[model samples]
Target: MVSKTDDKKAAPAAAAATAKPEEKKKVVSTIEEDDEFEDFPSADKEVIGWDAVEAAEKELNAWKDSWEDDDNETDFAVLLAAEKKKVSSAMKM
Candidate 1:
C-alpha cells in the first residue's frame, strides 16, 4: 500500500536510525585516538601537582649547578645518575 515516495522516505529514516550508533562509535573512536597518550596517569598514584614539578626542577638545577661548578665530579656524576634513574622509573609508570 506504500507509494514509491513514502517507501523512499521510510528507507532513509531506517538508514538514519541505524547510522546513529555508527556515528556514536565513530565519535568514540575519535576521542580514543585523541587520548591515546592520556593513558599514562595511574589511578593509584597521586597526581603530580605544581609542588612536585617545582621540586623536580630544583633537583635538576642542583644537578646543573654541580656540573657547572665542577667542584666535585663525583657529586655531579652521582646526581646525574640519580636523575637518570628517576626519569627511567617514572617512564615505567
Candidate 2:
C-alpha cells in the first residue's frame, strides 16, 4: 500500500535500521614493556676457540656476500647513528 516516494524514503530507514554498528579497533600501547628476559648468563657461556672464530667470520662473510645492492642497502654508520639516537631518547624517557 506504500507509494513509490514513501517506499524510497522507507528504504533508507530500513537499511539504516538493519545496518550493523562498527566494531571498535584494538589499541596497542607502545609504552608497555616486553616480558622477555634482559640479562642472560654471559659469564657461564662457553669460550670460542680460534677455529670457531674463523668459522664464524667465514659464515658472516658468506652471508654478507649474499646480499645484492637492490636490497635497499643502508650504511652501517647511518644505522649505528640511528640506534644511538634511539638509545639516547629512551634514556631521556
| Per-candidate RMSD, Å | 22.8, 26.7
- Reference-based lDDT, residue 24, model 2: 11
Q: After superposition, how far is residue 24 of candidate 1 from its true place, in Å?
A: 94
Each candidate structure's count of clashing pairs:
0, 0
Model 2 pairs whose backbones collide: none
- Residues 1-93 of candidate 1: C-alpha lDDT, one tens digit per residue: 333445546665566548676654665677665544433223213534466565456443434434366544587688998999999999999
TM-score of each: 0.22, 0.21
Residues 1-93 of candidate 2 have per-residue lDDT tens digits of 332544445555555435522211111233333443434323223343366555456443434555545542378857877889999999999
Angstrom error of the Cα, residue 81, model 1: value is 0.2
Identify the candidate with maximal lDDT. 1
Q: Which candidate wins on TM-score?
A: 1
Candidate 2 contains a number of clashing pairs equal to 0
